[model samples]
Target: MDEAIIAKGLYKRYKRVQALRGVTFKVPRGRVFGLLGPNGAGKSTTIKILVGLIKPDKGEALIFGKRAGSTGAKSLLGYAPERFSIGNNWRLIDFLVYVGRLHGLSERLAAERALYLLEWAGLGGYEEEKFGNLSAGMKKRFGLVQALISDPEILILDEPTEHLDAIGRLEVLNRIRELASRGKTILLSTHVLAEADYVVDSFAIMNRGRIIYHGSRLDVQGVVRIVVDKPAEFEKALHRAGLEYSISGNEFIVETSGVEDEKLVLRICLDNNIRVIRYDTSSSISDIFMRIVGAEKR
Candidate 1:
């Protein structure tokens, strides 16, 4: 896959805290890549370095082969930070236009793109509203608009859906999906693993300044839960099949490597003549996230 962004052995330190420790990952072009982790896990720091807001003390960050923080890379990237950094006084349209101009767009082009983005972000009639006067959801939507004003190849969003209502979150997620469909490479940094699972093609989970998990969502190992009429027989069948499994009360929790493994478990129960009562799979990003990060804490 063509890489849209690459971080090689990235290391950063802030006084006593080591924000990043040899972190490295690649975001494939034209896909939604998630940087998922808990608070203070260096998601923001990694994003900051990629967007040129801050420099890494060691290693390198690159955007499409150009060093991150370089003018060429900056032009290809659009970033929306975790916090709202725009001034309160500017009108929504004006603010977006200003951001576009800063990205080297002409005044006429800036206005044109701002108008289109406002509509795209569902902020059409609210263009004249002051930035401070909008609702929390509206502000988040506006932040997204400003980020897209430059028509960048890559969009980096930091906690885009944080603190929003369910409806607002849905709106933002749908917009992200739309952008990805149009071939824009997206880097989504969020602590919300479930939400990230909804949109990401692949993700990297970070904990305490280090990456603990990195893989495509389809390849994520998850547990398959099965309840059969005969617990003893089911356990015996699983053992005979040579599959790693754990017994939980009457349910069998089978560790699955992929979709194929999950299907194989069902086949094993059938072959053993075990009547299946309930078959369910729990492959939530949060499940593995807790397992990995919790292990590191120990």
Candidate 2:
């Protein structure tokens, strides 16, 4: 496969805190890859390293075939940080035009692209709006527009939908999907599992500065949902049987490989005299994510 981004054995430390511990992953060309984890999982640190804002204590990051942080690599990449830093007094169009010019675009072309992108991002008439005056969601939309001003091949977005409302989030997500469809290799970092599920082709789950799971969306495991009266006893039984599961209220989502595994779960319940209130074989991304993260905690 043609890899667009490669993070090989990357490590970083902030004084007493080890932010990233030998983290590694790869994103293929023209695909949407998700770097998923909760806040403080070192997702932001990894992104900073990739964007050349910080150097890793160990390992390396690569964009296409070029070393990450190198001019060659940076030229092909665009980034939107979790927190944006821009002049409060600058107008949206002017800021984007300046960024485009910095990327070597001519004055006229930069201005044209700035206007076009602002319109596409639903900030058309707001081009004259001051950066600080715009609402949080509008600022986020403009941040996205700034990232695309240079029309980069690879985009690294850190929580791109952070402050948007429901409708705004949907619009931004749809835009991301459209970008991937146009063959732009994107690396999206977010804590939202459903957001990743909506657009990412593959994902890596990070927790406590380590990568715990990495797989494609189609690699979703088979799971069975069971609700029983004796929840605590059933949990104990599950532990004795060495079966992995996650609890939410009266429900338990247990992983199963096949029919035999499903039968094993039922057998455990029967052996423990647990009264089954309901049972079904349905699962969701949130369930799977919680299960994986929960197992790591145990």
Candidate 3:
């Protein structure tokens, strides 16, 4: 199947709070799909449904054509929740092996896989460390290691880098990129758009329990930035052409559809004797996120 996960018109209400409102999106196979939004945006709720932790009050979710939360679907997936609890007494290696066994691995194989993964995740010599003894960053990485024990085809990570320092966040993100390179489909949910900016192939922004925008990262509509030597003439020309734009010093940012619109801007500048010093398309992920969610709020 081309789509790895599909949420179809999902709706869920808890007491007086509506967690999901006809939420819908698809995660394509072998690609990183980011579910981004602020807190209370229902990102967690949608992730829960995908991982079979909770059943939606209405609509359905599918995992490779299998009903979400079904045995078949669960077997092919790995999950790392934003917050998880483990006994303080449990040893890191033992916990991972136990989880591997539950997934049907032989005892010996489970131990072997656990050790390999722990080392790969930078926890090599800490196999015997108690769960509560590890540092916060190590604990988070351990959670990720355990989820990967069964070598799942799909990974669902909820706020994987939350509360981590800059370095910790980078380490976790690099691991995610490596997994994607190995052809594993990932559904990463986070409030920080910058965390997923470099890795995500496509994304959906959620707010108020609904998706405000969904599109490929490359297709995100960012402003066209132009640097001109004749700032006054350029500004006047833009005003005459009735184009929506913003100016800061010598740079002019014009919102445009594509190359055609860029060409139009260029022609306008040329006609007005406005020397175009530089022209480019540049916008950060956070910029795109704010634009989309802000518009939804209005």
Candidate 4:
């Protein structure tokens, strides 16, 4: 696959605290890559380095084969920071237009693009409003508009849906999917794994400034939880069916090879005349995240 971004042995420090420790990852072109971790896991620091806001103390970050922060690389990148800020006094349209012009667009072209973006961001009617007066969701949308002013090839978003309501989160996530479908490479840095799972084709899980796991979403393992009326009979059924499972309280977490295995577990319970109270197939990204982090701590 063609790589759009590469970080190799990236290390950063602020006084005594190490923000990044030998961080490395490759983001393929035209894919939504998730940089996932809890707070202070170096997500923001890594993003800042990629966008040229700050330099790494060691190692390097590259964009499309060029050094990060180089003019060629910067021109292809757009960024929406975790904590977005804009001049409060500036009208929404004016702010977007100014940002567009700063990206080297002509005045007329900037105004045109700004208007188009305003409509796309659902802020067409709020153009005259001051940036400070806009709601949290509106500000996030405006930040996205500014990032897209130059039609960047890669969008690096930090906590894109941080404080939005349910509706607002859905809208932003849908927009991200649309961009990816249009062949835009996106690096979404977020702690919200459940939401990220919806759009990311691949992901890297970070912990305490180190990436502990990275893999395609399709390869993520699935577990099925089943609660039954007869625990002893269920265990016998599982062994007879040659299925691996573990019991916790009243629930059995069956290790499934795929959808067929999940179905087999249900069939086993039925064949043994066991009553199943709950059959849960949904697996959470948070569960995997916590398991990894918790194991590392021990």
TM-score winner: 1
| TM-score for each of the candidates | 0.95, 0.83, 0.91, 0.87
Model 1 stretches with alpha carbons more than 4 Å out = none
User: What are the per-residue Cα lDDT tens digits for candidate 1 across 1-298?
Assistant: 3999999999999999999999999999998999999999999999999999999999999999999999999999988887765778899888887878888889999998898889989889888888889889989988898889999999999999998999999999999999999999999999988788899999999988888899887766557888899888878877887788878788787878888888888898778788889988866777778878888889
Instruction: Residues 1-298, candidate 2: write the lDDT tens digits.
Output: 4999999999999999999999999999998999998899999999999999999999999999899999998999999998875989998888988889889999899999999999999999998889999888888888888999999999999999887898888888998999999999999999988898789988899998998888776566458899999999998988888887888788898887666778999998888888899998755556668878988879
Q: Per-residue CA lDDT of candidate 4, range 1-298, in tens?
A: 3999999999999999999999999999999999999899999999999999999999999999999999889999989998899779999778778877778999889888888888998989888899999899999988888899889999999999999999999999998898899999999999998887789888899988889988777555557888999999899888988887878898998877677888898788778888989988776666667767779889
- Model 3, residue 191: displacement in angstroms? 1.1
- After TM-score superposition, what is the CA distance of residue 274 in candidate 1 from its true location, in Å? 0.7
lDDT of 1 at 80: 84
Which scores greater on lDDT, model 1 or model 2? 1
TM-score-superior candidate, 1 or 2: 1
Cα-based lDDT at residue 206, candidate 4: 93
What shift in Å separates residue 68 of candidate 3 from its native position after superposition? 0.9
Cα RMSD of all models vs. native, in order, equals 1.5, 4.3, 2.3, 2.7
Q: How well does candidate 4 match the true structure in TM-score terms?
A: 0.87
Ranking by TM-score: 1, 3, 4, 2
Cα deviation of 68 in candidate 1 (Å)?
Answer: 0.8
